[model samples]
Target: MGDNIRYKFDYLIDKGFYWSIGLRSSFSHFNKNITASLLLNDTEIDAMGLNKIGVELQDQTNQFYLQTLFRKDFALSIGAEHKRLEITSETLATNNVDEEFVFENTDYFSFYSNLKLDTYDDKYFPKNGVYFNGDLHWYLYASHFNKTFDAFSIAKADIGYAFSITDKLAVNLKSGGGFKLGDKTTQTLDFALGGYGNNLINNFVPFLGYDFISLTGNSYVKAYAGLDYNWLKKHHITLEANWANIDDDIFDTGEWFTLPDYRGYALGYAVDTFVGPIQVKYSYSPEQTKGFWYFTLGFWF
Candidate 1:
């Protein structure tokens, strides 16, 4: 569990120019103690000296950014960020688990530029328009613990479009991807892809039917399509499908027709309540043993 702190200030200027500066910081700790057989393959289980292994992780990040927007729909921002991670792993050994695996802490600094565009008709329920956002980061410096690269670059973009198909039906399509540039990079720059909820920092992408941040990759391409039908003025039904290809290597070239490694589908019903919208959904993934049920209030993040 962890906590996040954020502060921001905004200034308005002439000719539709909007400027703001912000700071965001967070800290988290994770304890991973599990039976080796549950997570390891047969070969891995045999190699492990302990029947159970445990890992403790600590993560922290601090970021500062100054951004400006021209007109109303497009904006650009630049920021600097520092991130640190420490991991310690324990396992049993022949001599009473004397041996332990400890990885050197990883700490790094980066400068990033972000651009965004949004023309959606509604923030809670978009029946028309498009949204686009992109980010580019250059890792120019790092602590001595980082032996991977002196400098590298990462780029990411997300685009979506929604349109009304009929009096009470709408179609929504979205595609997003990211990759590392340059020959040298660090695992710290990889993307974490899974789950769906509010916006997340540090290259986290929301994909339905999976556990939160359950998948990691150096690069990825994902697409989503959904149909929303308003059978009644305040009641709705929806169907969704998602597909993606996640890779450990940087930016692979492929067409959407190429078979993807991940796929998921969901059906949902929602009602607009006095306070917000209440939704119930059932999601399925072929890779999983069974489907998942979700119930939520307010707009679907």
Candidate 2:
């Protein structure tokens, strides 16, 4: 079983000033394996054996922010966010076999601001501009079984630029790297993606870019490329193909579990074109070792 809860608030202080806040929580439970026994003609015999497992997961998040538009060409903003996650799992067996339990927790804090320049409509470059965005974040994560605790922190600064290639196309580029400030061994960075759309599609927009992370300390690089397309004025589709390969001896440290080696493609689609404000979505992830599929439906304002 799984459940999630979320909340958000937005306020307009004035024509040029605004504030927003959000929160989220989640939980999950499941079972893993089981077994049974029987006897025939007074002779004991193994009737059936099964593996059953269960999982319970939970998450919570909160955010608050304020922004002010100083002029037609400039703006300023600030925000803070908080997040938490908890997970638990259990396994059952027969013949008096012992059960297993696992737990993990994570918490994070973030503060960010941006000074943006507006260049949305210029005859020479109708959809282009430059901006400077910066952020500071702290994270704390622990695993009960491993008896390990990680307190990591990082600060980042990014320079973003956008240019229009034509009335139908535009490109954006951002390149910046962050430095680890706490008990960590690697540097983190911020990247950007580019998107394109046309008036006729009104609902269909497509984008492509690389979202990547490098762990030089662990000697591994992970990256994903994908596209998001909208349809039917209320439907959305996303396709992401990811790849990751180990390059160093760090895998021997058992930390390899934190790395994403799925190395496959995933498709996700959602639509809100139903009556009574209902929404539906589906997803599939096929892997070399194991695979899974999911579906969801809901209604909201």
> How high is the CA lDDT of each candidate model?
0.72, 0.39
Candidate 2, residues 1-301: lDDT per residue as tens digits?
2343334344445555443332323322223121111001112222323222244544555556666665655566666656555444444333445643433355555565556664544311224666554555555543343244456554544454656554434444444333345553221111111122111010111121211111123233334444435444555565555444332333455444466543545566656544422322222333333333434444331
C-alpha lDDT of residue 202 in model 1: 67
Task: Encode model 1's per-residue lDDT on 1-301: one tens digit a residue.
Answer: 1243333233433333656776767765666553343334447668755455575656777778877885666888888988787656765434446755654387878898999998988654578999999999888877887665668888999999999989799998999988877743465456766666545656768777765555666688899998989999988899988888876553555543477788888999988888778888788889878777767777432
Model 1: C-alpha RMSD to truth? 5.2
Q: Which stretches of candidate 1 lie over 4 Å from their true place?
A: 1-20, 26-60, 70-72, 86-105, 144-149, 183-185, 250-257, 272-277, 297-301
Clashes of 1: 1
Alpha-carbon runs more than 4 Å astray in model 2: 9-55, 69-77, 82-85, 91-135, 139-151, 154-181, 184-240, 244-262, 266-287, 296-301
Give the clash count for each candidate. Answer: 1, 13
